[model samples]
Target: MGETGKQVVLTYEGVKKLEEELEYLKTVKRKEITQKIKTALSFGDLSENSEYDEAKNDQAFVEGRIALLENMLKSAKVIDEDDITTDKVNVGCTVKVKDVEFDDDIEYTIVGSAEADPGKLKISNESPVGRGLMGKKVGDEVEISVPDGIIKYVILEIKK
Candidate 1:
């Protein structure tokens, strides 16, 4: 058994990325890239063939990525969007925050690292800000000390 019986909370975006990558690997990359390998191999002497070397390298990388994605998908526990609520902070919940100092408001979805895109305001569970907001409720305050400084954030809203 795994260390934690609880399932991992993953955002829809995170799941999509994995699914897309897996599909691409099994369909497009596998067939097309493997063909590249076959074509390169047909060139005969592979010892000094740059084309063969590059193709082999690319093939290795593609296959390795496919294997990795397969493993992750096998162990995946996708979090349902319906499981999120505005009552309390949790993974998949879009958290609206207010900077207590600068009086600025920002919204972010607390998701797994795989789906976290800072520019998109998606935070990772491992992030300090995300950690501080976990299990918090609206109107609650959370303080996190970042590299810049310690900033206090107030929970404005939590949504699915």
Candidate 2:
């Protein structure tokens, strides 16, 4: 939806989150910054007014964020639920893998780059682990190359 070159893949939940953020920025944050600017303007002497300058900077940041959100939304592609399959690794699927070296099972929710939150076990398809898991089904073993060394994992489960 964005310009010809830009494409942003997102899940339904990701789209909702972005829409909520955009709404908050346009309504609440915009108003708060506008009020700050008005209060600063009342101080008079714009050349020496640090408050005014700060408010202007805040306004610029907010506007830039708004524009960025708009562009992202324009290019957003929501992955459909129907497209999710447990037979293989893909974005929007949850996968459980056993570390060959550690002998521990780790779960990861594969998502687009826009929604990658490693702390929450959500990984981007571009990540080393995610890339190694792509198109792999349960019982498949993968060897992923990381910066330190190669990590080996066996796919335990895949869920929608």
Judging by TM-score against the true structure, name the best candidate: 2
Candidate 1, which ten residues in sequence have the lowest lDDT sum?
Answer: 1-10
Summarize candidate 2's per-residue lDDT along 1-160 as a digit string, tens digits.
2344568778999899889999999999999999999999999999999999999999999998889888888888789999999999999999999999999999999988778899999998888888889899999999999998999999999998
lDDT of 1 at 108: 90
Q: Candidate 2, after superposition: displacement of residue 23 in Å?
A: 0.5
After superposition, which runs of candidate 1 have C-alpha atoms over 4 Å from their true positions?
Answer: 1-8
TM-scores of all candidate predictions against the true structure: 0.84, 0.90
Q: Give me candidate 2's TM-score against the actual structure.
A: 0.90
Q: Backbone collision count in every prediction?
A: 0, 0
RMSD of each candidate relative to the true structure: 3.3, 2.2
The best candidate by lDDT is 2
lDDT of candidate 1 at residue 65, scale 0 to 100: 81
lDDT of 1: 0.80
lDDT of each: 0.80, 0.91
> Candidate 2: misplaced stretches above 4 Å?
1-4
